[model samples]
Target: MVIPIHDKNPVSRAPVVTYGLIIANVVVFLLGPIAFAGPDPDAGRKARENAYLYHYGAIPSQLLGGAHGGHGAPVWPAFTAIFVHAGWIHLLGNMLFLYIFGNNVEDQFGRVHYLLFYIVGGALSTYAFAWANPTANAPLVGASGAIAAVLGAYAFLFPQARVTLLLPFLWFLPLRVPAWLVLGFWFVMQLPEFQQTIGVSSSSDVAYYAHVSGFVLGLVYAALVIGRGRGPDDPLRLRQKAESEGSGTPPLAPDYRSADPDDPYGQYHR
Candidate 1:
């Protein structure tokens, strides 16, 4: 899995929405496990503890009425699940990717538009997964689908932009690669996995279809939304002008430290 570490182009606007999303996801995960605490310590221990996720988790079967389970109270799991995570690794991974890619996309869409894009992207992704596996009975959760949208937007808006990645071959080594090369490669890789899961009989525990669908939607949405802006030559022209005038590689990575002085999460870095 090629994870993005940094973007080649920095955003001109604030990343309040991005950081807020990170905080929201973290808070939901913390509350989910505790809120859904079960009664029997052994019999339904796992089920009770994960009640919040199981009931609210995006289950294709439940959406299609092929299965039954999920919270009846509040009835907001569909949207809430986006913030809930199964574990620390899941939470951290999603937050990290969001922090890395979200800012630039936010810059492109502006805060309000970016927020809308994220929610709609996630909702679309969930619908895609439900459509693909309507009969499967499994709870789907995670911000991956939404984050995939951001990556898709990043791919289109800044294809020439570079990303700093840690290539794990023998040792952990950091290398810079063009965004198109990394994200495009990732977008292509999802197709095969999506195809393989097409006719499976068993319910897929993982929502792979959601990721693929969200990515495609993101690409289409970005093309329609951000594509109208300055042509592809604009960024290159600006970069060239900056370089000729003795500026460092185009402002790809934002100075997060200064962007949010009291960044409560403490994850933002320069």
Candidate 2:
């Protein structure tokens, strides 16, 4: 297993939307265990958890307009599911990915677009899972699908950026690998599960298709945006005024560019 710990990339601006998302997810998770406080705290916590999931988490059958579980309209759950988590590990893992990758993506698109991208990516993920298993009655929850979109964007937008990963194969030693290798390997690993789920031959409870779909969605989204010349405020162009006036070359390196630019080989520097 390889766990991503950090990255060496820097963003052009503060990721306000990314921080808001992390906080929102954490707050929602904390509210779950105490939502139904009663005579028995433990039992209440457990009951509240179940209630939270059933009422707010997206159920495949329900999302597909089936009668399974007979939950009401799926709109709220489709949006809320991204904020709901199964446990601390699930919450932390998703948040870590969001914290690490989301900033750069947000930095590229600005706060509003980034927020919209996240919500739309999550909604699309839920729909993908529902399409993959329209008969499934299980409630799907977590920010994994959404964060998978962020990873997808990172894979495309910052493929050469270095990320530190702790691999169990190397006795948990850290390895600084390029973003493409890490995210690409992860997307490839999900293929087997995605195929199994499509073939209706897997027993895994995890939603692999959602992860795959979100990734693809994010990849396409980023590709379209970047193709249309939308990118982090062009650092080079922004300094053109000073450079044109011969202000000592603006004090920054030309190679310090966005992940994808007209020149793909330009190396990103600190």
Candidate 3:
């Protein structure tokens, strides 16, 4: 298995939208019934979880018609499903991707646009999943689809940026590689899963269709709509400016630092 550690790219702004999205997902997961703080069942922990997931999850049948699983899935659950994670591992995995890749995209699109893109991309992806499995009854949950969009945008906009990945095959060795290669590998990995609409015959709960659709949509949208946003306040300029202010480098880059100062992603020299 491969796990992304961090990226070399830095953002021009504070990425409050990314931070806010993370906070919102975490809050939803904690407050939701799938967190096990729900109405305690006499038994069947798994049953309660299944019930909870299907209740709030975006069921293809409900979204597309011919409802199954006793009752219909939540009304228009695409938006709600993005905030609901089925388990701790699910929550952490999605959040990790979001945290690692989301900031730069948010910076590129600014807060509002990025947030709208995220929500719309996620909803569209969920619908794509539903379209494939029109008869499926299982509910789809988690923010993977939206995070996949962030990955797509990041890959397209910062193809040369370095991303450090932890490779479990090599005993968790850290491998630093270009963003395109990392994202390309991710795309290739999702290919087989893409053959199936999520929740059809798959025992696993992963929404691979959503991931594929969101990634493609985000990539296309990044190219057509955002297109890197490398004007006056580009990432390179911010990095250079940040370095010059702190390091001994000459102050040749434009100043784009926010009025409030504390930046955790310290000055990048190279």
lDDT of 3 by residue, 14-122 (tens): 8788889999998988887667644554557767677778777888878877454444443458888888997778899888889888988897787889899999889
Model 3 clashing-pair count = 0
Stretches of model 3 off by over 4 angstroms after superposition = 36-47, 66-75, 193-203, 228-270
Highest lDDT scorer: 2
**TM-score for all models, in order of appearance:** 0.76, 0.79, 0.78
| Local distance difference test, each candidate | 0.71, 0.78, 0.76
Residue runs of model 2 more than 4 Å from their true location after superposition: 34-45, 66-72, 193-203, 231-270
TM-score of 3: 0.78
Worst 10 residues of 2 by lDDT: 261-270
Q: Which segments of model 1 are wrong by more than 4 Å?
A: 34-44, 66-76, 192-204, 229-269
| lDDT measured at residue 91 in model 3 versus the true structure, 0 to 100 | 91
Error of 2 at 114 (Å): 0.2
Ranking by lDDT: 2, 3, 1
21-89 per-residue lDDT for model 1 (tens digits): 999998887776643443435656675656656776777666656444635542344565677787777
**Tens digits of per-residue lDDT for model 2 on 189-227?**
678655566574543767889999999989988888853
Sort all candidates by TM-score, best to worst. Answer: 2, 3, 1
